[model samples]
Target: MTQELKVINFMGIRKYTSGFSIILTILAVASIVFQGFKLGLDFTGGTQLEVQFDRPADLAKIREVLEEKQLHSPVAVTFGSDADVMIRTQDQMSIKGREYIAAEIARLGNGASLQDVIRPTREQEGFVDVLVINNLTPDQVAQSGLFDTTRFGKTIVATKDNTTQIAIEKGLDLVYSQHLLKELEVATGASIKLRSSDSVGPQIGDELRDSGGLGMLCAFALVFLYVAVQFQWKFSVGALVGLIHVTIVTLACFTFFQWDFDLNVLAAIIALIGYSINDTIVIFDRIRENFRKLRAVDPIEIVNISMTQTLGRSIMTHVTVFLVMAVLYVFGGELLAGFSKAMMIGVVFGCYSSIYIAANATVAMGISKEDLMPRPKDETEGGADLTP
Candidate 1:
């Protein structure tokens, strides 16, 4: 014998829940429109440095020191651990410097390929441009071109003698990696070892941002097509609305709070679209099944019965997922902070939109038994037919 589920009057308070959803959506839209997002280095194109500290790092003091030294708007935050810090700066190497370095390095030899060039701008002696040249030895590079001159001008060889390592101090006025490392060490009173340094051009960052946005739009359109084929156009619209709700609200939280919106966070939002839609699809499936099974029941009653039956499932799924997201948020470190937070918000609102936003929209659109009824073969060819 099957267990009897307690039918919930889900639609009884639909007005209140619908109003709440509308209010949330409106607030979310307003926040996004006004506050915008705090774009990260990945989107805004800047210099990033990762450093490992001998002890726990003090972010505030580090920022203070950088500011006092006038290091061009440095933003410091703990990365993976208290002992690790990542710093981003608006300071970027001029394209002129990069092109000149690249061209000059290529002139050394046919075998010499320019990999990267980081111009150090610190006032410290022996700190200069770090050139990563592939297929070339340090001695070979040291004996040739700018290196031959900079060697006499007091260039420092900061890396081990290898086929790849080369540093040339042209005594340029720009200050960067070595400068930042010295300042951080003095500020935090810890041995600051440079872990990594990277630079992204503004043009590249803009391209990435545009690609991410286009990817999200494609995701929405594909989801609409999927739901339309699997269920019906009415359910498809509802699913789309639900997805938009989760996305906008998630973005709103980030925008209003001024959280860093980077490529990682964008990826999380895309992942959220799938997760939120799964819940919506589950409810839609149940509603379709009940519409067929309970021929005598009204649409509202059918929805309530379906929701009541799936309540246990929805609760279990959301709780399990939420627990996982909580762990990630707490322990996944600063690099994934935005991603995990976005996921956590998605899981919460995913459940809500699936029930209140998606399902309610379908119901309010006057969904009935006939809309989900089995269709003839010709009709089915043109539309969805859930006939078993």
Candidate 2:
């Protein structure tokens, strides 16, 4: 049951579609400039704090408490999620702060319950630089058994009678005391202690940013060269044009949503270049074949017919890829959210540009009936370049 497919007569757009693309490119650039991006902690260093509670917690009051401690304007993210409280502050982590945290939660009656500190900026390089040397004022060890020593960070043991000692450096910055400690105990169902330093440096972020950008440029250039060699320069022009379209569209989506431009996004964009060029190649192959059959048609006519013939296939491929990307967007963890979003956007626009954009540029190269049509077998009147 091979049904005959009618060739869609698209009247076909003129070859000079580059002007339209220029407009789209302008929009993307404008978006990039006026609306900056919301960079993630991975690219920009910041502190992320996760605290759990037996009951719903109020962040406004918690921020107020931190404000009283000289740390104001903390970015809090808590919508009943595992990592509810994420604070991006300019202040650095330090020692002797654990006591202050514990005292404030109890004094303010804030039911923070449990707390875990993550210094994405510092921790990327190494742990904290500060240290905490606690010298407890006790005969030996304060086993009040009442102080719920398990809830406290730690108690110092002395060789002599009741005396005291204290020093501070940083490690973990985690404190187990008061309500915060109790909630931590209930949450983890285990005794916990704050030890070791957690810190991040700018060097790792800078290196990642540099490598990602460099890799994308190198990959794109290599792909452009390969396509140019495989097809004629005009066909390569189409493929490269489509690739640029996909890249800009994807990047614009990132900027619009304020998603961080990280290595994953960069990798996704590179993958898109390959995907877009592949579709362009499929159309170009069909156009070349049609040029042989329609010996008298303009190159633009062959391009249009080929696109019409391949439209169904293009739709099928992009739809399948889009479905998988949708799954990742919905079910994948936070780590993959950005990557999935980027892929989804690229695939959609990549297909559209492959047909409407890439082919248009090839036609715009002044392809005429003579240049587009396949040459006939050598004849007496044929050009000297052909053999008898």
Best by TM-score: 1
Candidate 1 minimal-lDDT segment of 10 residues: 167-176
RMSD of each: 11.0, 9.3
For 163-203, candidate 2 gives per-residue lDDT tens digits of: 22211122434432234334444544544332222344456
lDDT of each: 0.81, 0.60
* Residue runs of model 1 more than 4 Å from their true location after superposition: 1-3, 52-85, 93-174, 376-388
TM-score, cand. 1 = 0.73
TM-score of 2: 0.64
What are the per-residue Cα lDDT tens digits for candidate 1 across 261-307? 88899999999999989988899999999999999998989999998
Q: Which stretches of candidate 2 lie over 4 Å from their true place?
A: 1-4, 9-20, 46-169, 172-200, 368-388
In candidate 1 the C-alpha lDDT for residue 307 amounts to: 88
